[model samples]
Target: MLTHKGDKSGIRSDFISDYDDLADQWWDPRGPLAPLGWIARARAGFIPVAGHEQARLLDIACGGGLFGPHAAGKGYRVFGVDLSEMSLREALRHGFDEVVRADIARLPFDDESFDVVTAGQCLEHVPDPFGVVAEACRVLRPGGTLVVDTIADTKVARLVSITLAENVPLPGRPPRGTHDHRLFVNRERLTGVAREHGVELELLGLRPRLREMARYAAGRLEEVRMVRTKSTSVLYLGVGIKK
Candidate 1:
């Protein structure tokens, strides 16, 4: 859930700073960013076994490394990158082989430096998610996988991801100012950008499992599973392979 430092939104610097404050709770299933862990599990399905030995995977905006565990046992030398030093430290302890403090839009790695790249749940916080997508593709070798998930720009998305998600009084609910609707992602533009970068992205919707959500609200479950759907109008994911 890291935000851009050069964000034109003028509202995400505070959001980025919030990561420091919440760093200790990143792995807590009952913590504010618990949804990230749930989505990471779903994202794992798209990540194939390492194609060869010593494969490398880069996790952009790898706040707290929720995906690290899922990435394990698959053989990738997982590298995490993010703007929050505190979050990077947390990620380092959570199975990531290494971590880098950097912005997602401008990766410091050389082209074709990675076998896989993932940007999860952070694009909606950036002013230029498409540029970040290009950077992701640039670092991925041909035939490498690219996976990303984000909140959509639709009005329904604003209502659900921001208006309800941040405002609802449920356990582990994010702070009221956690998201900026103006920075929500456009699915069409996201797919187009990936295509231009040689990755043919296939978009899919993600939604909380209702019965599990009710259990989570009632304290019966520590987390809720995000199921895939045909629609990409709200919370959605994009997965593809670089050509």
Candidate 2:
């Protein structure tokens, strides 16, 4: 995790600015601002197994508290954290149980502070992913769960991923390259990193279909419209248990 202090918090500062600008839209569940339905879908894949209501959960890089209420409403004790103060403020405005402004790479929590630690789409933007993962591990109790969802890396899917991402009408979402160039990883690489951190893999799957590429080319996009093209551009969703 990169620690940002003083006048320069580095890349995190820049990313926070982007998130802050989109805070209001990000929290809204309706319209283009809502999370691509795939997020709720992906979270569902693990939430059942993770035991939402009884769990002590942390939503790392939870901009505008998008996923927190869903989990909180389910009965989990949710704490949302982000580098953007504006995002946190908006989260608090909506009555989030607790919201903190902290970089995910360097979480300020004590060891084993949470039962489930999640970083959805937030990993790729960090300067030190290994450190961020380590921090997630640090805060999770032994046998706790770690959930991650990020863009997948597949050679066959790259071209289609870029083309569709550019054409898609996602809200609050900018063009592919406008944000920092992303870091894409396959499941083996992801599981390897989790293994290095002593977390056991529980589940891994693509939420949106890989063949959605053909739908875009065939102009039958709505047939797969419910599928999240953004996360499905190849999404890597997994739950790892810390041993």
Give, for candidate 1, the lowest lDDT window spanning 10 residues.
1-10
Per-model TM-score on C-alpha atoms: 0.94, 0.72
Runs with alpha carbons beyond 4 Å of true place in candidate 1: 1-18
Query: Which pairs clash inside model 1?
Result: none
Per-residue CA lDDT of candidate 1, range 33-142, in tens? 88889999999889999989979999999999999999999999999999889989999998899999988889999999999999998998776889999999999999
RMSD of 1: 2.5
Task: State candidate 1's TM-score.
Answer: 0.94
Which runs of model 2 end up more than 4 angstroms from their true locations? 1-17, 28-33, 48-55, 93-95, 169-182, 208-233
Per-residue lDDT of candidate 2, residues 1-243 (tens digit) = 222222354332323334665655664433333434447445744653445446777888877766654565555677888987877887766546788888787898999878888887776666566677778888988888888876566653454444555447653234344223334555566677778888976544454454753554455653222233333336556687899
